[model samples]
Target: MAPNRREKGNTVSDSDPHFSGGGVAADGFDRFGTLPDCLLVSILSLLPIEDAVRTSVLSTRWRRLWTLAPLRLLDDSALRSEKFPNKKLLAFRAFHDEEQWRTQEGWRVRAIDGVLSAHAGPIRSCRLSRVYFHIPLLDGWIQTLSQKGVQDLAILIPMEKRFYLVHPSLIACQSLQSLELCYCRILKPTQPRPNLVNLRVLNLKRSLVTDAAINDLLSCCPALQSLALVHCAGLRRIHLRSPTLCIMMLDDYSWEVEELFVVDAPNLEHLMLGKNTTRRTHVKVLNAPKLELLGFLDMSIKMLQLGSTTCFEKSMVTLSTVVHSLKKLAIRVDFNDDLQADIVFDLLRCFPCLETLDVLIADMDDDDEPDVEYWKQQVSLDCLDHHLKSVTLKGFLGQRTDSGFVNFLIAKARVLKVMTLISVHAWKEGWVETVQQGLCLQNKASIDATVVFMKEKHEINQFQPWSSLF
Candidate 1:
């Protein structure tokens, strides 16, 4: 203290008696001091509220850093240990003051509460993955986030026996733009918020939301652009009537809708239907003037009713219903070999203007007869016309029914360009390849066609060179 160190203009680290080899270098102070306030804030913004709060211990400069950070509320224990190997579970455990099993549960509740209380302003994004909390608390948290103008929300709730309710406040989020709910339960519709005019995207995959609830939610969002209801159970019918919806996808293994009414979607361009119950369902095609793409899978369309109820009870979809001004057509059927040849012919006849056709022709185990030169003579491709330039056949069993269609396609397609035949089930001794080679010899000018035989089940890949329009 002889000539006080501060007065002597020497740095504090140099003057300290205990600084001989303590490793408290002058650079340590500069590290925090040199960081721009904006950079510090941005770094803090990415941290979970609890982690952000711990910044205060770093230095006096970080005492109020977390107040400006975005809240990342998560069930701390629900986070698999595999993700963060360095995660100090002991620190969280101490805050929880419980055993390993019980501390995790307490951590989640505390983490959520800490984030909500600390976030004074609107949250830009919230990512809650595999979180478990009381339903009421979730509702309240959603309400809190909505009021604060949370924009992006990704919620993956724990699959519990109890139902989960979507709070009405969630829809009220005026700044909300994107929402993703996976494997969740929408127990009931919450109150509607007035600020949800800007919402655009909603994805509910493998969710437990009823049709009525979905309808109610959809009706509320007037500006919605994309809606994907994938494997959402309890929907027997979906009346999708949205003027602003450009893309609508319904892919549920248990989706057995008797009727799907598309009323006012004029701008709707892409419609995808997948894995529906084989039972009868009257699908009404609405006035989508701009419609261009339609894809279906595992669907047995028993009736093809156009604008009128004039029923055409066919197991497969007629080509007319598919190729109407559409550039891309995908048909994936799960039918038995018992299908009538006439029905298959009718299905092929409808695609007049189809430039690209990808058909998955699968048959039951009972279909073993491979020779079908005689049967091929009976099928007609005159109606199919010359529009088909590119075609793909998946799960081709090299049976009479499949080969019959192949030979007809080779002979009748006037402007055929490229054809890909893939054999599914064990190849009946190079059945598809044999057909491909035979077709090439008969029609050298019948466009470039190739067949690929999958020797094993795992060898079957996705239809290559085809863009999934949906």
Candidate 2:
């Protein structure tokens, strides 16, 4: 039998049998236990926290090794499982016994506390979701992790009316590089604002934060490069002026925001704005000179004013030279909307240097047909005549309107090299051959232009069908 468990203060001496070559048998065979400490710690880090802690019973040599491994504790499995009764016996019992629910909840809390208390090394990351934690206990855990030099932290709670304010220690931690918070309330700090000098990435989703609070946070993080805000309330206007910010994504599906203004991010490269279904918001891009990629999905905004223009009317759009630097553009169009077709043309004209265009067709009802004559009447744009090389049409339903639009692109784009048409629905008997034959008959401006037909199997953004070409 193994020797008695060693206390935390005990140190392994070099002369000890277990510390030396005891794992090697007399026959000269090395056992798995002979692996070095660093390799063993790595293996332990990959297992779940509970399983890793249970390994302490294997032998005296492995008793305290878990304390040295970087810990990652995520309490999301219980919430993610559909059959909750099978996950924990106590959970099943909780349905009948209120005391059992408290027991199970206490066990979960203790499990997290035990692992965090026993850890002797830096925690690489911690993501806690769907666990009900009191404000004091949550604050204590955040403070403890902050002091432990945690680099990445994510706290995601359920979308209940209850809002847990973030601990001050977490905001002021200098060791933190990435932070993501979901479904929580961010309280404004006291005067002489805190600075997260090392933070590079920040994501806030479904959180409540005032515009002033957001500006204050951004002002302190000089090194912030990427910021994403999804469905966050309490901000009617968002003004970003970061110098190092490269990517900004504002996905507001709730349509709570009324205005978004990108004031002066010079280094910004990619900007994605979710469709404003309410059609009440307006976006203005004042100064991102280096902006190359732009995506506007489900766009129904009243106005998308570019450059320093002050006009808010939808008909008064005037593109500046900054948008001409764009290399790629993605947009979604609803055929039912009369302005959508005109909006596409206006956008293409603005982005004269665009090399690739991705179009997602929305609302495929039979009554919502594209105006074929309107597409035919569109004068050739500079992008189609010179810069555009690739075009991807997702949700192509093989309608007369879709075919007319495809034919218009085929005949006008002189430098077009590849045109990908992904069917909106499943493949039928002669769909591929029919589309191919139709596209082949249309007048192609470039002899090298190739039309590729594919069935829609996955999301438009998840897989890039054009990656093989590059």
Candidate 3:
């Protein structure tokens, strides 16, 4: 036996008789290792991410092959596995202790740095979640990623902890396309502000995004298409005037948002608001002719202005404010009184040609009774009479109040093709049959209409939370 030596992060045996002069015996068993560099790199790229990285241990030649493929790095998900109730309680306690959480996540951040040091471009994406770091380290990492041509990047800080300031290098990155930040804050760019010309998608959740920060960023993102702001604070007024933006979502209830006024958006299609039932922002649209999909419109908006028409406290449809261009509409309703139910009718009248209606029902007490006369006084609107084809009701509890609303919709939607009742809080065994018989779904106005039922306590709709639309 002879000694084995290490060289340049690789292992080699100088005393092995079977290996010599960069060539192995023709009849040897090392068939795959004999392949060319291009083929070897391609093969390594096909393997799973971890498997591909482990191949670097094979030989000196193989060590650098993993670096040639695209880089997708992650040091995320510190508590993703602790989803059980007992585990969640334990995690909830630890999560609130900032120091302990930071200490535990320190190793993952170190590993992220190690991988970046060892890997080569082009880095496709990098995701860092639940890992807090000192400002300097995170700034350095962002610079490194920009240099490596990172296209998609996400950094999610833990909730209830202090937020990090976004580094300027990230915005100045020439090759970056998508950026998602959570629990962070953005400073208004200084003199000679950098432009994110190539950026396309921007999603900010639970961040301290000031109006100045957002407006400045919006001006620089000439190519942005999708924008979502979820529960973000410090935005008093959001005014967008873009030619390329197509999808925009606003879920922030931060009292700062006084008004969302879109002055000009030539290509805008989806303008989704929040599902908040308590407060509403005055949304005034001056120009968005291409707007086709609008969702989760709360009944009590401060002032809904589409073009010149002012939507106010009235619960009646006015011809001037009709949004006939809207193809799909989603709304949030209280369903407690005729007043609240009339607001829905008014909304339907405003969108005479709506094809899809997705309604989110507010949670109500079981013992409470609803004013059924206001619902009885409800006449079929143009949408329900001729245009509406699909109806999706979320949070149906099969209560007496629920039966009235469901039956009203079932009877009036003459063209309704499908009605989905997502029962999130119904516990009774025969609740489904009860809702069916009580609502008289089989006698729905639309002769060929189909009914769909779902138990959705654990699974939400695909386009819910209003953030996913963008």
Candidate 4:
């Protein structure tokens, strides 16, 4: 081979003889090498950073393509290997092999740092999951990203470590449109807060953030549309006052949230509230005119105040204005003998225009069967008469109360097309057949109505059950 050489900065062009077939030939052609740089860079961007960088060795044309591509850095240990251990084994490994743990941690840090340092363009997104790094290194990387005008950033530390307080520069990034922080802490800014004018989505999971800090952050993001806070610590009372917020989810499995208040959110559309237990929390939804989807799961709230005059006490209540805009509603509650049917009826009455309803029955050991008499006392609602179309009931036990509630829906919901009942407990001999026969015999208001019965083994075994409704 006579000195195969090219000038510095000379990239392989489509017309190059070597690329066209003089020297390079794959499957009798060099189609890949002839592709445009932008298209190649897009292909590289989808691969993991490590894999993307390795492509640099393929050819001179590919050497610098990855650096120009939008950077997507993900440090997920679970994706590191196919045989990754379970949580218990991971905990054991973290405690037993200190040296190996440190070595792996250092390798991940260097890998991420090496890529961020070499890349010269704006990063599209960066996600670091279950990775621990030195505070200075993390701060420097965040500062670099801020300066580079990163659009999306996610920093998820390992659950075993203490909450890592994010750097100030990260919060001040004007280019950020979406941000997610898990197992971290959002510190109170010292001086004037930076207005994240473009931020639309914000998710904080298992974080340690005070109510004041969160409220202040929301105030700064005037254009925020979606916000999710899951199992956050030090958040007893959350007052959301965003005017532009459209979707919000609050999942405090620890049951630490004592009070939740939403005010002046005119554009609010979807709201999800979840708690692990049936804890008594105060929730108020006010001034949300465009609200459509509402989910209140795993809690028997003490009071749910909707607007000014409408409120739900221990039983339930209705807000005509609030429910008029609601199209979908989901709720999970423990079965109370005296209040189960009343609660369901009150909820249905509140949302006169609701089309979809999902009910997840929390398993309680007590034998407090659902109150079947309350079904007869149910006042006619527009939802049951005209609007309600779909009903999904999980954890159905086929008890008298459960069967009666189903029977009432079959007879009352004039527009209901589907009723899904998944049994949480194991079926006794001929129980499923009997329940199906009883539901079918009931005079359904809608002639097109169909009943679906599914046996959820995991629900009965006390394991988490998956729902196909969502």
Maximum-lDDT candidate: 3
lDDT of 3 by residue, 296-322 (tens): 676655567776566565343344777
How far in Å is the alpha carbon of 8 misplaced in model 1?
A: 18
Tell me the tens digit of each residue's lDDT in model 4 across 325-401. 99888777655555645556666767789998877776644666555566656656798898889888878877666
Question: Superposing all C-alpha atoms, what RMSD in Å does each candidate have to the true structure?
Answer: 6.5, 5.6, 5.8, 5.1
**In candidate 3, which residue pairs clash?**
none
**For candidate 4, which ten residues in a row score worst on lDDT?**
461-470
Clashes of 1: 6
TM-score of predicted model 2? 0.82
Worst 10 residues of 3 by lDDT: 77-86
Q: Rank the candidates by TM-score, best first.
A: 4, 2, 3, 1
TM-score of each: 0.74, 0.82, 0.81, 0.84
The lDDT values for all models are 0.60, 0.71, 0.73, 0.72
Worst 10 residues of 2 by lDDT: 461-470
Model 4, TM vs. native: 0.84
Candidate 4 residue runs with Cα over 4 Å from true position: 1-23, 26-39, 59-61, 76-96, 275-278, 297-299, 309-322, 334-336, 364-371, 426-429, 457-470
Clash count (model 4, backbone only): 0
Predicted candidate 3, C-alpha RMSD: 5.8
Return the top candidate by TM-score.
4
